[model samples]
Target chain A: SQTIHQWPATLVQPVGSPLSLECTVEGTSNPNLYWYRQAAGRGLQLLFYSVGIGQISSEVPQNLSASRPQDRQFILSSKKLLLSDSGFYLCAWSVLGGLETQYFGPGTRLLVL
Target chain B: AQTVTQSQPEMSVQEAETVTLSCTYDTSENNYYLFWYKQPPSRQMILVIRQEAYKQQNATENRFSVNFQKAAKSFSLKISDSQLGDTAMYFCALASGTYKYIFGTGTRLKVLA
Candidate 1:
């Protein structure tokens, strides 16, 4: 079975600090990767997605950016974090060209103070 | 452009009962996909059900089912014999000619024992 993993299950960052969240999928090849954010009691906002290595399509323009350094490894980064950048960060994956279902990781909770 | 709407902000149901969560979407594309995702207190996004715009038959998974009205652009999730484990925030999403999904504001469901 395929599984998605994310690092730093919980994070606390000060304002204006750097941010890096990692996501990787095991047991799948050529999978589509995505990054999403959800504020408390709010819906998810798509930040970025990658169809392949070194190819990323951003959905929202904000303080975050994404990069696919490897086939199954995706990274979401921010040079300087903002107070509004705090939320639940989710990483998801699906089969290449498979839009029917998306598998998500455990997620990272970032609290900016 | 695509948009998903979930009017219910919160709901509660007793265990062993049936509950339906409503979802509506707007899109110009004829061929697309709709999905329902569950986010538990753990904050992991889990795929509950999926429906293809071209499919007329409703999709069912165990105690979970969907009433997919393609022409009406409505997809509702029905949870039968609901259990306490079903307590979570449910999100409706749409994907149309895009690499990412557009999500609706979540409906928090609490299945009481």
Candidate 2:
């Protein structure tokens, strides 16, 4: 079975601080990875997605960026966090080259103060 | 461009009762996929059910099932014998063959004891 892992499960970052959230998947290779953000009581907003290493597509333009440094390893980063950047960040992975179901990680809750 | 719409922002139902959450999408492509995801209080995104555009039969998983109307562009989720554990934010999503998914704003389902 495939599983996705994300950390730090919860984060508290001061305004203007750097941000880094990591996601890794096991039991699958060359999977499609995605980053999404959800507000307090709102729908998910897609931030970025990667089909392969070094290839990323941004769904929305904002303070965040994503990178697929290795197959099955994806990272969401920001040079400086904004108050608006605080939310529940989710990482998901799906099978490659197909319309397979996406599996989500536990998620990272970032609180910016 | 593909878009998903969950008309209900919030819904409530008595435990053991059945509740249907409505969802509709817009897409120009004939071959695609639709999915329903549940975000529990634990904040983990769990795949509840999935429907392929090419298939006429609806998708079902245990107590959860989807009413997929391709011509109507509607894919509503019905939860039978709802439980408190079923309380969560349910999101509808559309994915084309290109591997890109567009999510609906989501509906908050509250199952009262």
Candidate 3:
């Protein structure tokens, strides 16, 4: 069985501070990874997705960016955090190629103050 | 471009009752996929059900099922024998032969005990 892990699970960052959220998938290789954000009382907004290592596609350009440094490791980062950047950040993985079901991690709740 | 819509913003159902959450999507592609994801209070996205466009039969997983109308572009999720643990935000998503997934705004479901 495959499992996705994310941390710190919850984060509190001050404005203009750097942000880094990590996601790693166990028992899967070459999986498609995605980054998503959900504001309070809202749905998900896809931020970035990667089909392979060093290949990242931005769905909505904003303060955040994503990188797949390793096959099973994906990281969401920002040089500076904004108040608007506070939300529930989700990391998901799917089978390689298209139209596969995505599995999500426990998620990281970032509160930018 | 593909888009998903969930008409209900919030709903409540008594325990053991059946509730249907409406979802509709727009896509020009003939072959694609639709998915329903559940986000509990923990904000972990759990895949509830999925439907492939090529399959004629609607997909069902235990107490969860989907009404997939390809022509109507409607894909609704039905939760039978709802439980208190079913209280969460349900999101409808569409993947059209790409890495991109468009998600609905989400419907908050409360299974009252």
Model 3 chain B TM at 0.98
Off by over 4 Å in 3: none
Ranking by DockQ: 3, 2, 1
Q: Which ten residues in a row have the lowest lDDT in candidate 1 chain B?
A: B93-102
Predicted candidate 3 versus true structure: per-residue lDDT over B42-80, tens digit per residue = 889999999999999999999999999988999999999
What DockQ class does candidate 1 belong to?
Answer: medium
- lDDT digits (tens) for residues B13-107 of candidate 2: 99999999999999998789999999999999999999999999889999999898888999999999999999999999998867678889899
Better of 1 and 2 by TM-score: 1
lDDT, each prediction? 0.92, 0.93, 0.93
Docking class of 3: high
- TM-score of candidate 1 against the unseen true structure: 0.97
lDDT of 1 at B76: 96
User: Candidate 2: where is the Cα deviation over 4 Å?
Assistant: none
In the range A1-78, model 1's lDDT, one tens digit per residue, is 999999999999999999999999999999999999999889988889899999999888897989998999999999
